[model samples]
Target: MVNTISHIHCQNCSMAPLCLPKNLSEGDMARLDTIIQRHKPLHKKDLLVTADAPLRYLYAVRSGSLKSYTLDDHGVEQIIDFHLPGDLVGFDALATGRHRSFTQALETTMLCEIPLNSLDDLSAEMPVLRRELMSMMSSELYTSKQLLGSLNNRAADARLAHFLLGLSQRFADRGLSGKSFRLSMTRADIGNYIGLSVETISRILSRLQHENVLLVENKLVEILAMDRLERLAG
Candidate 1:
């Protein structure tokens, strides 16, 4: 049987609007609840969906973060995207009924797993839910397109600068220290996502630190000059 929850209030619940179908009424939410499954708590670095695993559930983060990646023909891991609290892990996988990439938790996480087969039924029955689902899919595509543009047109420094700001905004959404947050993604992951080498990523970060754009303390980044960081991002 699928696990179900009642309501989602961003201020109270761990998951926010990212996972929840926005503007869903009590009746709509109740219908979705019937097919929702609550997954087990995951620890940091715990693998959720490995490449080629049976794609069964579309997971929404109830708490914490997840990172999805895939290995190329050369066995080089390319970090695809980062999914923090309220982010959805896989929905496209349902099309093929197979996972094409790996998804692992960056921090201890709890997820709400919705059986893929049931999603269509819910969407068809609820107009608001259907629109919200389409919105999420559009947002994901937009993020991917943005990433491609950044890789093609932006310099490595600008890429890293923009990436940091994006992360800051994500952190702020979860009530975390947005500007002075710790990096959960590794340098290698960062390099892969930004289309740069680990050395290059390090160099750019070091340059930013020296430029007084931020104060670095291990994995933590404290922004010292917001305007300077914005200038670098551009």
Candidate 2:
């Protein structure tokens, strides 16, 4: 954990609507800045919140990404959710003091910590805050439902296709790209979530690359033949 967060990167990301930096604009966003606190920058594989850890603040992703997952009895990691820039990560701890899943940074990550009690007070004072909170919750529910639908109805290829598409959408939402993006999650993590093996993931990726559908280099995925990739995903 590096103390003194990188503020310049914060400026670059804040201007984009994807991250919660937009929370600074007007209404409650203004009030939010008053109580919000930035934590130490986390490098790859750093744990933000551990399962069963005490919940103190509402977390917002300033930059980078986070993945939350839990271990089964056999010690296999089951990914719960992946949080992108401007996304909230620790909502499940709102009512409970203990976290149900552990959240870890996927890259060099920055975070905004809002004391839950302070947010509660602000929500009481600002109707905009309350409404926005409700909307965020609703949106998350819809996303979960959609992911569940994919898991139930889509095949392995389609599921992976949809997963990549979903990532593109989230990236685009945060002012990133549908055609190019960085992959911080490992093939094993992706395989576990999509019910595939790591070797299978590698094979599929290579197959796609060989077909000129995309290019994968050092965790960067470039959509060379974007439509072709989408077709395979179908």
Candidate 3:
């Protein structure tokens, strides 16, 4: 079920605050709206962008979630990142002009496609767009470093805790409930991202629930004790 809306304005987009046009002026936003093309809903496991494909547009996730991954020599998929609503994907191709990883929908997803060629002209006229793009790239780099550090951790519990805490903060940034949210990724996906086995991920979650630090019901998770979770993450 895809819903494509024509003539949508960034100034009125619910995700504007967390998107590229967060601080853009009204005039700039109108100009931006001209270049954005809203896509229909992508069903689960649909590829938004394929690895090695030529990059044409940057995608702003409007709703639902997506995952970026790459396959190893043995054909094992190495999950790299989870993109939530308000996250931008395809920036990795800015320098190379080709996507390095596959981006696939984790569930039903909607996005706004920003033509990359339009950005140069737009940025030249509106300096704020350039600065915002740079800021967003820097933030993405920082997140990559953080994920690298998390992957190096030997403790399974710590990695799991860190992952949950990270998601909580991200959800909070989107003006959503930080204490409770449904996880779009499955336990197997979580294990692959955090360098743990699926059984280990289940064990750690069970332990957290046993300690009353979290409450997990299927995919829905509620952090009952944020302070405890933070300590565990550390």
Candidate 4:
């Protein structure tokens, strides 16, 4: 059965600092809470939104991770981005009112959905939320640029190192351990995101492990030498 959660007050939400309600007044927090719809855990691989679907709400990852990807003309899946807890999804729909990619849970995930219309209406009364949304969108754009830069004329090892380092920093931002973490996405998904074949990704991981730079067993990654990884990323 699909699980659903009852709405909760924004002031009590752990994700408020990382979400649109960051720095909001108590009055604004209460107003923001009214528009949020909470969901129970979504099993891994369950789609939260699909490409071309009508856009109604923006989803915030309250827990776990998700991936956003799209299929090309030849039907090959191209991963666009991975969303961690506290990251916002569905902003790509803002321009066209339809999703441009599919967002799927990478693990059992919980989300808080913010109705777009209600958010806009509430934003007028709570300007801080509006500014927060803009800031979040800008941050997404910057991340996209970084992705593009990473994909351009870079070695496979460098790309992988960069990706790992990036993930580490993102986790640290969420108050999670940066040195040790599990990868929610598989090797193939990582390969797709980094523009490499699965075999190549495996080889790179093996090399890193041999060099004592990382400890990778299945999806779990322990960064044994972050300084070395950063230098390799450079």
Per-model TM values vs. the true structure? 0.89, 0.88, 0.97, 0.96
Model 4 poorest 10 in a row by lDDT:
1-10
lDDT of 1 by residue, 17-58 (tens): 556654677667667777886687889999999998988788
Write down the lDDT of every candidate, Cα atoms only: 0.80, 0.77, 0.91, 0.91
Best by TM-score: 3
For model 1 the TM-score comes to 0.89
Question: After superposition on all CA atoms, what RMSD does each candidate show versus the true structure?
Answer: 3.1, 2.7, 1.3, 1.7
Question: Which of the two, 2 or 4, has more TM-score?
Answer: 4
Tens-digit per-residue lDDT, 144-231, candidate 2: 8888887886667777777888888888876668889988898888887777788878887888789887789968998887677678
- In candidate 1, stretches whose alpha carbon ends up further than 4 angstroms from where it belongs are 1-12
Worst 10 contiguous positions by lDDT, candidate 3: 1-10
Clashing pairs in 2: 19-86, 20-86, 23-29
TM-score: which is higher, 2 or 3? 3
Give candidate 2 misplaced runs (Cα > 4 Å). 1-16, 19-27
lDDT of 3 at 33: 89
* Error of model 2, residue 162, in angstroms: 0.8
Q: 97 in model 1: Cα distance from truth in Å? A: 2.7
